[model samples]
Target: MSSEVGTEALTRRGLMLVLSSPSGAGKTTISRALLKEEDNLVMSVSATTRPRRPGEEDGKDYFFVEPVDFNLMINRDELLEHAKVFNHYYGTPRAPVETALSEGRDILFDIDWQGTQQLAQKAGDDLVSIFILPPSTAALEKRLKTRAQDSAEVIAQRMSKASEEISHWREYDYVVVNEDVDHCLAEVKAILKAERLRTRRRAGLIDFVNRLREGY
Candidate 1:
């Protein structure tokens, strides 16, 4: 045998599967489910200027960097995309993503609309963005409250920001209403299955088809 390879059985370029949603919209939940069930899919670890929380590793949770270092990365164009949020900076490094694509291993990005837009501009064809929307406004608020991870003030802030986030739904390649987690996850998986078949992503597809034609 040559070597142990990725779970993908085909010779194809990997894609960036970006799932964006407002707080408590089930995007994170669906992303976890997808990673658990799907083969050859890996999470995209981002670099941030924010301080790491308890139990979060340096490289695992995020590549924690100083603001100056993050600025250097931006200046060097080492980052595929960078954005400032809530007085902190976050960005995706370009090198690992390119390597993963060449190796035919898909990457899952749990990002926001800002990052998704930058990724689209940087690597349009490689990106498949999906925006998750809640069933209704009231339902979204209820979910936020049920999670109980934030204070009343923070929940209110998220709810307010959610309206803005939801407005960018039209920018995504696909949109899924996340009323039901299982059903929504199924739809997202279906989308991934179909996107994997895109002609451009199949690296040797043209030559393979030609070879088949010659044999016939």
Candidate 2:
């Protein structure tokens, strides 16, 4: 039993794990933590038409492109999911993602609910989406204020928009209230482990079972 236990890992197809949440709900914090701890899990860098900011790298931070090139990629079906935000287009390129999936390397998407929906339409079988929620509106507001990056007006605006974002919680496969960052991260990690073990994602599962049935 000791020798056979955890001897071999199964060959599995990868999944697209999406994390979405309202502002100040701790999704970004959770995402950073996951990337730090999870093996074979990497962030999905998006191609963007937005101008590169200072200290941002090309292809590393974002695949910065011109508006025309971005349109061309969309027309050519080179993007798995794409969306316009603040007059700029951002998209996940199809090629690298497909390659990663086939090689059983998971991709993490820190996208909004709308982008998650777009990914669902194109890759539902490979997608696992989670929505993070704050324990209460008051707590969420408190978090936004604590950040100190926003003025009173901006914080108020973010709170208003958070209401709309929170309404889409039902569309996610899993929802976790981020009252505590450590607890919330653990919940998400559990979800990931279960999803990775799913039969459909295990590429050689059928062969492995058949060998056992043959008494090998």
Candidate 3:
């Protein structure tokens, strides 16, 4: 006889959404859009030994630290995943990510395949990995050139490395061919929505269902 509809209470465990692609691909653009639109998600800030560039703020862009400190963190097992890239060490701190997951706040990671592999190994169930690919090889080249930030030699280096990056496409949970930015964004968003709905991710669902059946 109750007119009101019953709503079950549930709490979802946060997921680590990883978006990786070759340099010229549109993962960065897609990541920016996702962060802007997704309210419950935050970018996973990484600590790096690389020098802070102009307009880069410590703890904002990256937690810039000395090489010695980075090594110390590695030795202490404080980093969830760490890698040496171009002679600079980059890593994600474990404490903050654990806190976020406990609070049910999703974290977005923009990292390479190696870092993704490390995270997958550490937190397989909590992670959703997506790999973005350009529409074509020529398109990838065009995008790198259009940026005009890197020199020709650098562009060539990136192009050469892209093949190896793309080869890891099979490793991801989802693959988006980034021919259209809007379409790709929508696809990734859809994947996130579906992943969030997974029964394993939503805690208290079983209890809520039992309460409903008992007329509570």
Give me the candidate number with maximum lDDT.
2
Clashing pairs in 1: none
How would you encode candidate 2's per-residue C-alpha lDDT over 1-216 as one tens digit per residue? 122213234778999999999998988899999999999899998999999999999978999999999999999999988998899999999888999999898999998888988899988799999999999999999989998978889998999899988999999999999989999999999999999999899865666666566664
Error of 2 at 77 (Å): 1.8
Q: What lDDT does candidate 3 reach at residue 6? A: 38
TM-score of each: 0.90, 0.92, 0.91
Report the alpha-carbon TM-score of model 2 versus the true structure: 0.92
Residue-level lDDT of model 3, residues 1-216, one tens digit each, is 222323434567899999999988988899999999999899998999999999999878999999999999999988989998889999998888989987788999998888999999988799999999899999999999998888989998989899889989999999999999999999999999999888888774776666657774
* Clash pairs for candidate 3: none
Model 1 misplacement above 4 A? 1-9, 149-151
Tell me model 1's lDDT, rounded to 2 decimals.
0.90
Q: Which candidate model has the greater TM-score, 1 or 3?
A: 3
Please identify which of the two predictions, 2 or 3, would achieve the higher lDDT against the true structure.
Answer: 2
List of clashing residue pairs for candidate 2: none
Candidate 2: segments with Cα more than 4 A from true spot: 1-9
lDDT, residue 54, candidate 2: 100
**Relative to the unseen true structure, what is the C-alpha lDDT of residue 138 in candidate 1, on a scale of 0 to 100?**
89
What does candidate 3 score on TM?
A: 0.91
